[model samples]
Target: MIKTSTQNELIQYVYDELAKNASEQLETAFMHDEELAESCSELLQIQNLLDNALKSPHKRAVQNILNYSKSLSLQS
Candidate 1:
Protein backbone atom coordinates (compact mmCIF):
# COMPACT_ATOMS: atom_id res chain seq x y z
CA MET A 1 0.00 0.00 0.00
CA ILE A 2 1.21 3.53 -0.69
CA LYS A 3 1.88 5.69 2.33
CA THR A 4 -0.52 8.58 2.89
CA SER A 5 2.33 11.06 2.58
CA THR A 6 3.33 9.55 -0.74
CA GLN A 7 -0.27 9.67 -1.94
CA ASN A 8 -0.43 13.36 -1.00
CA GLU A 9 2.79 13.96 -2.84
CA LEU A 10 1.36 12.23 -5.89
CA ILE A 11 -1.59 14.60 -5.83
CA GLN A 12 0.74 17.57 -5.53
CA TYR A 13 2.83 16.25 -8.40
CA VAL A 14 -0.23 15.82 -10.58
CA TYR A 15 -1.29 19.40 -9.81
CA ASP A 16 2.24 20.82 -10.40
CA GLU A 17 2.38 21.94 -6.76
CA LEU A 18 5.25 19.76 -5.54
CA ALA A 19 8.63 21.40 -5.00
CA LYS A 20 11.35 20.64 -7.52
CA ASN A 21 13.36 18.39 -5.22
CA ALA A 22 10.33 16.45 -4.12
CA SER A 23 9.06 16.17 -7.65
CA GLU A 24 12.41 14.78 -8.75
CA GLN A 25 12.31 12.25 -5.94
CA LEU A 26 8.85 11.15 -6.96
CA GLU A 27 9.93 10.77 -10.56
CA THR A 28 12.77 8.54 -9.42
CA ALA A 29 10.32 6.45 -7.43
CA PHE A 30 8.17 6.13 -10.53
CA MET A 31 11.05 4.49 -12.35
CA HIS A 32 11.02 1.63 -9.83
CA ASP A 33 7.31 1.61 -8.92
CA GLU A 34 4.82 0.82 -11.61
CA GLU A 35 1.87 1.25 -9.26
CA LEU A 36 2.97 4.77 -8.33
CA ALA A 37 3.37 5.65 -11.98
CA GLU A 38 -0.02 4.18 -12.80
CA SER A 39 -1.59 6.17 -9.98
CA CYS A 40 -0.05 9.33 -11.36
CA SER A 41 -1.31 8.51 -14.82
CA GLU A 42 -4.83 7.98 -13.51
CA LEU A 43 -4.73 11.27 -11.63
CA LEU A 44 -3.60 13.06 -14.78
CA GLN A 45 -6.50 11.56 -16.72
CA ILE A 46 -8.99 12.67 -14.04
CA GLN A 47 -7.48 16.14 -14.01
CA ASN A 48 -7.82 16.40 -17.76
CA LEU A 49 -11.46 15.27 -17.60
CA LEU A 50 -12.28 17.87 -14.94
CA ASP A 51 -10.46 20.58 -16.89
CA ASN A 52 -12.48 19.90 -20.02
CA ALA A 53 -15.87 19.56 -18.30
CA LEU A 54 -18.46 22.24 -18.99
CA LYS A 55 -18.11 25.22 -16.65
CA SER A 56 -21.41 26.99 -17.05
CA PRO A 57 -25.02 26.07 -16.53
CA HIS A 58 -27.06 25.61 -19.69
CA LYS A 59 -28.70 28.75 -21.10
CA ARG A 60 -32.18 27.35 -20.49
CA ALA A 61 -31.36 26.74 -16.86
CA VAL A 62 -30.09 30.27 -16.46
CA GLN A 63 -33.16 31.68 -18.11
CA ASN A 64 -35.43 29.65 -15.85
CA ILE A 65 -33.60 30.94 -12.78
CA LEU A 66 -33.94 34.52 -13.98
CA ASN A 67 -37.59 34.10 -14.69
CA TYR A 68 -38.19 32.61 -11.25
CA SER A 69 -36.36 35.49 -9.60
CA LYS A 70 -38.36 38.02 -11.60
CA SER A 71 -41.62 36.42 -10.57
CA LEU A 72 -40.62 36.37 -6.90
CA SER A 73 -39.56 40.04 -7.03
CA LEU A 74 -42.83 41.04 -8.67
CA GLN A 75 -44.75 39.21 -5.93
CA SER A 76 -42.77 41.04 -3.23
Candidate 2:
Protein backbone atom coordinates (compact mmCIF):
# COMPACT_ATOMS: atom_id res chain seq x y z
CA MET A 1 0.00 0.00 0.00
CA ILE A 2 1.10 3.52 -0.77
CA LYS A 3 0.93 6.13 1.96
CA THR A 4 -1.07 9.28 1.30
CA SER A 5 2.04 11.41 1.45
CA THR A 6 3.74 9.17 -1.08
CA GLN A 7 0.76 9.28 -3.43
CA ASN A 8 0.64 13.07 -3.13
CA GLU A 9 4.35 13.33 -3.81
CA LEU A 10 3.76 11.54 -7.12
CA ILE A 11 2.45 14.70 -8.82
CA GLN A 12 5.91 16.18 -8.83
CA TYR A 13 7.67 12.88 -9.37
CA VAL A 14 5.65 12.11 -12.50
CA TYR A 15 7.23 15.06 -14.22
CA ASP A 16 10.57 15.03 -12.45
CA GLU A 17 9.52 18.42 -11.18
CA LEU A 18 10.42 17.88 -7.53
CA ALA A 19 13.49 19.05 -5.63
CA LYS A 20 16.31 16.58 -5.05
CA ASN A 21 15.21 15.33 -1.65
CA ALA A 22 11.57 15.09 -2.62
CA SER A 23 12.48 13.26 -5.80
CA GLU A 24 14.59 10.82 -3.86
CA GLN A 25 11.72 10.17 -1.49
CA LEU A 26 9.42 9.53 -4.43
CA GLU A 27 11.88 7.09 -5.90
CA THR A 28 12.16 5.23 -2.63
CA ALA A 29 8.40 5.07 -2.29
CA PHE A 30 8.01 3.79 -5.84
CA MET A 31 10.57 1.09 -5.26
CA HIS A 32 8.68 -0.26 -2.28
CA ASP A 33 5.10 0.40 -3.33
CA GLU A 34 3.58 -1.28 -6.35
CA GLU A 35 0.40 0.79 -6.35
CA LEU A 36 2.30 4.04 -6.17
CA ALA A 37 4.53 2.91 -9.00
CA GLU A 38 1.50 2.18 -11.19
CA SER A 39 -0.07 5.48 -10.25
CA CYS A 40 3.12 7.32 -11.10
CA SER A 41 3.31 5.55 -14.43
CA GLU A 42 -0.24 6.64 -15.26
CA LEU A 43 0.52 10.19 -14.21
CA LEU A 44 3.59 10.19 -16.41
CA GLN A 45 1.50 9.18 -19.41
CA ILE A 46 -0.97 11.96 -18.70
CA GLN A 47 1.85 14.45 -18.33
CA ASN A 48 3.31 13.41 -21.65
CA LEU A 49 -0.01 13.85 -23.41
CA LEU A 50 -0.44 17.31 -21.86
CA ASP A 51 3.08 18.26 -22.86
CA ASN A 52 2.45 17.18 -26.46
CA ALA A 53 -0.76 19.18 -26.63
CA LEU A 54 0.90 22.28 -25.24
CA LYS A 55 3.68 22.20 -27.79
CA SER A 56 1.51 22.96 -30.79
CA PRO A 57 -0.18 25.94 -29.16
CA HIS A 58 3.11 27.22 -27.84
CA LYS A 59 4.68 27.07 -31.27
CA ARG A 60 1.74 28.93 -32.79
CA ALA A 61 1.97 31.64 -30.11
CA VAL A 62 5.68 32.03 -30.61
CA GLN A 63 5.21 32.37 -34.34
CA ASN A 64 2.51 34.98 -33.82
CA ILE A 65 4.82 36.94 -31.54
CA LEU A 66 7.63 36.79 -34.07
CA ASN A 67 5.33 37.95 -36.85
CA TYR A 68 4.08 40.83 -34.73
CA SER A 69 7.64 41.83 -33.90
CA LYS A 70 8.64 41.74 -37.53
CA SER A 71 5.68 43.94 -38.47
CA LEU A 72 6.56 46.41 -35.72
CA SER A 73 10.17 46.51 -36.82
CA LEU A 74 9.15 47.21 -40.40
CA GLN A 75 6.91 50.09 -39.23
CA SER A 76 9.83 51.63 -37.33
Candidate 3:
Protein backbone atom coordinates (compact mmCIF):
# COMPACT_ATOMS: atom_id res chain seq x y z
CA MET A 1 0.00 0.00 0.00
CA ILE A 2 1.16 3.52 -0.72
CA LYS A 3 1.97 5.76 2.22
CA THR A 4 -0.81 8.19 3.15
CA SER A 5 1.52 11.18 2.76
CA THR A 6 2.47 10.05 -0.76
CA GLN A 7 -1.19 9.64 -1.68
CA ASN A 8 -1.99 13.09 -0.30
CA GLU A 9 0.91 14.55 -2.21
CA LEU A 10 -0.39 12.95 -5.42
CA ILE A 11 -3.82 14.47 -4.82
CA GLN A 12 -2.33 17.91 -4.22
CA TYR A 13 -0.08 17.51 -7.24
CA VAL A 14 -3.03 16.75 -9.49
CA TYR A 15 -4.72 19.95 -8.28
CA ASP A 16 -1.62 22.08 -8.81
CA GLU A 17 -1.43 22.65 -5.04
CA LEU A 18 1.94 21.04 -4.44
CA ALA A 19 5.03 23.22 -3.94
CA LYS A 20 7.37 23.58 -6.90
CA ASN A 21 10.11 21.70 -5.12
CA ALA A 22 7.79 18.86 -4.09
CA SER A 23 6.35 18.70 -7.59
CA GLU A 24 9.82 18.38 -9.02
CA GLN A 25 10.65 15.71 -6.49
CA LEU A 26 7.55 13.72 -7.34
CA GLU A 27 8.27 14.14 -11.05
CA THR A 28 11.69 12.60 -10.55
CA ALA A 29 10.18 9.78 -8.50
CA PHE A 30 7.53 9.10 -11.12
CA MET A 31 10.17 8.86 -13.81
CA HIS A 32 11.98 6.16 -11.85
CA ASP A 33 8.91 4.32 -10.54
CA GLU A 34 6.33 2.96 -12.96
CA GLU A 35 3.81 2.39 -10.17
CA LEU A 36 3.99 5.99 -9.03
CA ALA A 37 3.50 7.16 -12.62
CA GLU A 38 0.46 4.92 -13.01
CA SER A 39 -0.93 6.14 -9.72
CA CYS A 40 -0.50 9.74 -10.80
CA SER A 41 -2.16 8.98 -14.15
CA GLU A 42 -5.16 7.45 -12.39
CA LEU A 43 -5.39 10.36 -9.95
CA LEU A 44 -5.35 12.84 -12.84
CA GLN A 45 -8.13 10.99 -14.65
CA ILE A 46 -10.26 11.03 -11.53
CA GLN A 47 -9.54 14.72 -10.99
CA ASN A 48 -10.72 15.51 -14.50
CA LEU A 49 -13.90 13.49 -14.03
CA LEU A 50 -14.58 15.32 -10.75
CA ASP A 51 -13.92 18.69 -12.35
CA ASN A 52 -16.49 17.91 -15.04
CA ALA A 53 -19.02 16.82 -12.43
CA LEU A 54 -18.62 19.89 -10.23
CA LYS A 55 -21.71 21.69 -8.95
CA SER A 56 -22.65 24.15 -6.24
CA PRO A 57 -24.31 22.84 -3.13
CA HIS A 58 -28.09 23.18 -3.18
CA LYS A 59 -29.48 26.28 -1.42
CA ARG A 60 -31.38 24.16 1.08
CA ALA A 61 -28.31 22.11 1.86
CA VAL A 62 -26.28 25.25 2.54
CA GLN A 63 -29.00 26.69 4.70
CA ASN A 64 -29.28 23.47 6.69
CA ILE A 65 -25.55 23.42 7.34
CA LEU A 66 -25.57 27.04 8.41
CA ASN A 67 -28.49 26.44 10.71
CA TYR A 68 -26.76 23.42 12.23
CA SER A 69 -23.62 25.45 12.83
CA LYS A 70 -25.60 28.17 14.57
CA SER A 71 -27.23 25.61 16.85
CA LEU A 72 -23.84 24.15 17.75
CA SER A 73 -22.46 27.62 18.47
CA LEU A 74 -25.43 28.37 20.75
CA GLN A 75 -24.77 25.13 22.66
CA SER A 76 -21.15 26.07 23.08
Candidate 4:
Protein backbone atom coordinates (compact mmCIF):
# COMPACT_ATOMS: atom_id res chain seq x y z
CA MET A 1 0.00 0.00 0.00
CA ILE A 2 1.45 3.33 -1.09
CA LYS A 3 0.79 6.30 1.10
CA THR A 4 -0.32 9.55 -0.52
CA SER A 5 2.99 11.23 0.27
CA THR A 6 4.98 8.39 -1.21
CA GLN A 7 2.80 8.35 -4.30
CA ASN A 8 3.21 12.09 -4.78
CA GLU A 9 6.92 11.90 -4.27
CA LEU A 10 7.23 9.04 -6.72
CA ILE A 11 5.27 10.95 -9.33
CA GLN A 12 7.52 13.96 -8.93
CA TYR A 13 10.54 11.71 -9.24
CA VAL A 14 9.11 10.24 -12.43
CA TYR A 15 8.87 13.75 -13.92
CA ASP A 16 12.38 14.71 -12.71
CA GLU A 17 10.92 17.41 -10.51
CA LEU A 18 11.93 16.10 -7.08
CA ALA A 19 14.91 17.35 -5.09
CA LYS A 20 18.07 15.24 -5.12
CA ASN A 21 17.88 14.09 -1.52
CA ALA A 22 14.18 13.32 -1.71
CA SER A 23 14.71 11.46 -4.94
CA GLU A 24 17.37 9.31 -3.31
CA GLN A 25 14.97 8.50 -0.48
CA LEU A 26 12.29 7.52 -2.96
CA GLU A 27 14.79 5.34 -4.81
CA THR A 28 15.68 3.56 -1.61
CA ALA A 29 12.00 3.11 -0.84
CA PHE A 30 11.40 1.69 -4.26
CA MET A 31 14.09 -0.87 -3.64
CA HIS A 32 12.43 -2.07 -0.46
CA ASP A 33 8.73 -1.64 -1.21
CA GLU A 34 7.37 -3.98 -3.84
CA GLU A 35 4.12 -2.04 -4.12
CA LEU A 36 5.97 1.21 -4.66
CA ALA A 37 8.12 -0.40 -7.29
CA GLU A 38 5.07 -1.76 -9.09
CA SER A 39 3.38 1.59 -8.89
CA CYS A 40 6.42 3.24 -10.42
CA SER A 41 6.39 0.74 -13.25
CA GLU A 42 2.74 1.51 -13.89
CA LEU A 43 3.36 5.24 -13.79
CA LEU A 44 6.17 4.83 -16.31
CA GLN A 45 3.82 3.08 -18.71
CA ILE A 46 1.23 5.83 -18.37
CA GLN A 47 3.86 8.49 -19.01
CA ASN A 48 5.02 6.66 -22.10
CA LEU A 49 1.49 6.60 -23.45
CA LEU A 50 0.99 10.28 -22.67
CA ASP A 51 4.25 11.16 -24.37
CA ASN A 52 3.16 9.39 -27.54
CA ALA A 53 -0.31 10.92 -27.49
CA LEU A 54 0.84 14.50 -26.85
CA LYS A 55 3.49 14.91 -29.51
CA SER A 56 3.90 18.27 -31.24
CA PRO A 57 1.02 19.56 -33.32
CA HIS A 58 0.85 18.68 -36.98
CA LYS A 59 2.46 20.77 -39.75
CA ARG A 60 -0.84 22.39 -40.68
CA ALA A 61 -1.41 23.57 -37.14
CA VAL A 62 2.07 25.08 -37.00
CA GLN A 63 1.56 26.85 -40.29
CA ASN A 64 -1.80 28.23 -39.17
CA ILE A 65 -0.28 29.65 -35.98
CA LEU A 66 2.54 31.30 -37.92
CA ASN A 67 0.10 32.79 -40.40
CA TYR A 68 -2.07 34.15 -37.63
CA SER A 69 0.93 35.68 -35.88
CA LYS A 70 2.09 37.30 -39.11
CA SER A 71 -1.37 38.74 -39.69
CA LEU A 72 -1.43 40.16 -36.18
CA SER A 73 1.93 41.80 -36.66
CA LEU A 74 0.80 43.33 -39.93
CA GLN A 75 -2.35 44.70 -38.28
CA SER A 76 -0.26 46.35 -35.59
Model 4 stretches astray by more than 4 angstroms:
67-76
Model 4: per-residue lDDT, tens digit, 24-70?
98889888889999999999999999998977779999999999999
| TM-score list, all predictions | 0.71, 0.65, 0.64, 0.74
**In candidate 4, residue 46 scores what lDDT?**
96
> What tens-digit string does per-residue lDDT give for candidate 2 at 3-59?
787776787667566789988877887787888888988988988888888634578
* Each model's backbone clash number: 0, 0, 0, 0
User: Which candidate wins on lDDT?
Assistant: 1
Candidate 1, 1-76: lDDT as tens digits = 8899999999999999999999999999999999999999999999999999959989999999999999999999
Cα error, candidate 1, residue 73 (Å): 29
Q: Relative to the true structure, how large is the alpha-carbon lDDT of every model?
A: 0.96, 0.80, 0.92, 0.92
Q: Which residues of candidate 3, in runs, are more than 4 Å off? A: 54-76
Cα deviation at 57, candidate 1, in Å, is 7.0
Tell how far residue 61 is off in model 2, in angstroms: 9.3
Specify the poorest-scoring 10-residue window by lDDT in model 1.
49-58
Residue pairs in steric clash, candidate 3? none
